[model samples]
Target: MAESRSKLVIVGIGDDGLAGMTESARRIVAEAEVILGAPAMLSLLDGLSGRKEALEPDMPAALRQVREALASQRAVLVSGGDPLFYGVARYLCDRLGKDQFEVIPHVSSMQLAFARVKESWEDAYLTSLAGRPLEAVVDRIRTAEKVGLFSSDEHPPNRLARALLDRGIDYFRAYVCENLGSPDERVTQAELTDLASMDFDPLNVLILIRKPNRPDQASRAGRHRLFGNPDDMFAQTLPKRGLITQAEVRSIALAQLDIRPDSVVWDIGAGSGSVAIEAAQLAYQGMVYAVEPEPADVALIEANAESFGVPNVRPVPGRAPEVLASLPDPDAIFVGGTGRQVVLVLRSAYARLCPGGRMAVNVVTIDGLATALETLKNLTSEVQVWNISIARGIEQMDRVRFEAINPTFLLAVTKTPDVSD
Candidate 1:
């Protein structure tokens, strides 16, 4: 009869690896017939009794190799830091089924990284660069007040810092913690600009803590903006500017839409996504679909979404009505532009709206307003229109003069039961 295969043990290692492991953890590693780990992880267990197997950098392939070895002898798979906290333990269990393995966790380097920076990480944005794209990292970092990143070979600290700086994200004070828990452990602190040119060890965690009073590079959290927020308060496209939804118009449309804390909304002509961005804050638990046809505008919307730290707003790169088919049916729809298809777009949007949903349309042209009113009347019995003309008070000499902006028309409609039939 063949000998029964022993269960695989996945052990989390600190910067000190086996040297810092508990007695029980050390016993598991010493008795294993085959031990699997990355080159760096394997280096920590040199001259150990077990036959060491260096794991490949590719995780999926390494997992398969580990499983094959487990079929014969006692096996141990080693990982850096806490195995479940952005470490390999979760991936192994998830991929191979939980019944196949047992996990022994240690303090995560992310935790150590935060500890070294003297910041609480319970609410921080934690992510890893290992095997993930840089774009994902950049997007997450854009609005995070505190971020803990597990650096990768391709996306080292310098590369990450440069990427952030190039995108005009400079509000963070970065701390790079290397060889955590080891005697040679070092933590380097610098501004993003300064870090862009620096070098650090491959085994490092990058911690970013936002500086106080610096305009949060990311969007502010929660709804209820101060009456007059600076234009820079929002994430807007550079160069091809003035495309952001004007703050005044956004406020009016949001009010007309009757946005609740959890109201699902769509900004059909999202442009630079200012309307959808603000609406995301107001509807924290709700989702906002910022639909735009232009690719560049979609990119801007994504940047703005990250800048504002509003994960609820999803940027859909396509025209309205066409893209509307895929979105979760919305409670409110803000139509920013119709491009001569005002009636058609409004009618289609209303059809997809949930019962009692609100629709608000903003039109600068008289023709667009006429089309909006006609379309809105067909959808519901209750229709309200506001001709909003806003003028900012400018200090000229000793007198304050009102600088008038082009008047805008807001058409708001609520779905109500038709009294007739």
Candidate 2:
């Protein structure tokens, strides 16, 4: 986990200039002693003047400048749209610890694009072509019914359309929403073939809605397994399916825990026990305790463990804090949705985390994020935070679209080592 560096503030801006920014965003920018952004982004700050520095064209130079500005003064790094969604926040947070900065987001252009087409975006597969590889999103698009893509100067609408056509998977009706929120904004409706032949404004959103009655086809790759296998791959019950620690999330949490092959691990609020199972995969020689309260779910955990064929995981049937007492000290710990008692569970779990070990907690509510941060920060300074928002693409009624998992915050910290040793 990365250590907290500076208390940096990042504010998201939109095309409507400062008017588009929230009152909170405006105030943060106003109070900033120094502001840093690209030339075009800085141009939007017409009246709300501050000592602003235009970032250098080179990415490394830009990051260095941002680090310096943030470290030296009350600086705001301005970006367009929700900074966490494929924006500067993810990049910066990954490099510098998430606890170092505060993020304020604006309505993203991707959201506006979905709105312009009058399509509800809750199920749309959204992505940006700015830095993503073409092949990566192509297979996903082959199965999706609706997609909202942020087109870049390098991978514009025409090129994207052409690539899809070459794949022999062309059922989408296209909409190019250009220069959104500007006076000269345009929305061009066209077929896939028409889209392939024409140019679009560089600043544009490409929306793809599948033609009606189109059936889904399996990707040539088959149901490729993810590191933290998909939710369905595990044997989980109905309402519990929704409650299971998500595959990608557990993968992240496991990474934060830094579990080694011989590490003794404890998973509080283990739920369906996917996190414990995956941890068992890594800690093949180690022991993983799946601590759950419900008896039926405890059986499900054992079943899932058997299916994975990992004998290292033990399902402990009882509530946390109390059940935690019987367990051995842990080299690493993972706490899932323990709800209101999360603080209690974390306090007890942290006590068992061996010195220089790691603890990672996953929470869904703002209160959880705050209280978890407070509890962990009281114990260790090597704290890192991540806000994960993800959508999974699944086939429905022979067509594919995304099912969004609610936003989650992951907080991980490293316990300090004992000096006497």
User: Which candidate tops lDDT?
Assistant: 2
Q: Give the TM-score of each candidate.
A: 0.53, 0.52
Q: Write the per-residue lDDT of candidate 1 for residues 1-421, one digit (tens) a residue.
A: 9787677899988778678999999999889888988888988887788888888766546766877977956889888877788777766765456667889988888888888888999988887776454654676688788888889888899999998887778989899999999999999999888998999989899999987776645532334362224456765567746555567877778888888755779999888778887787777656789989989888888887787666677889887678777776678999997675777899999876766678888888888888788878877777899898878899999999998767888888886533341
For candidate 1, the 10 contiguous residues with the lowest summed lDDT are 219-228
C-alpha lDDT score of every prediction, in listed order: 0.80, 0.82
> Global lDDT for candidate 1?
0.80
lDDT of 1 at 324: 78
Model 1: CA > 4 A from native: 1-3, 217-421
Clash counts for the predictions, in order? 3, 0
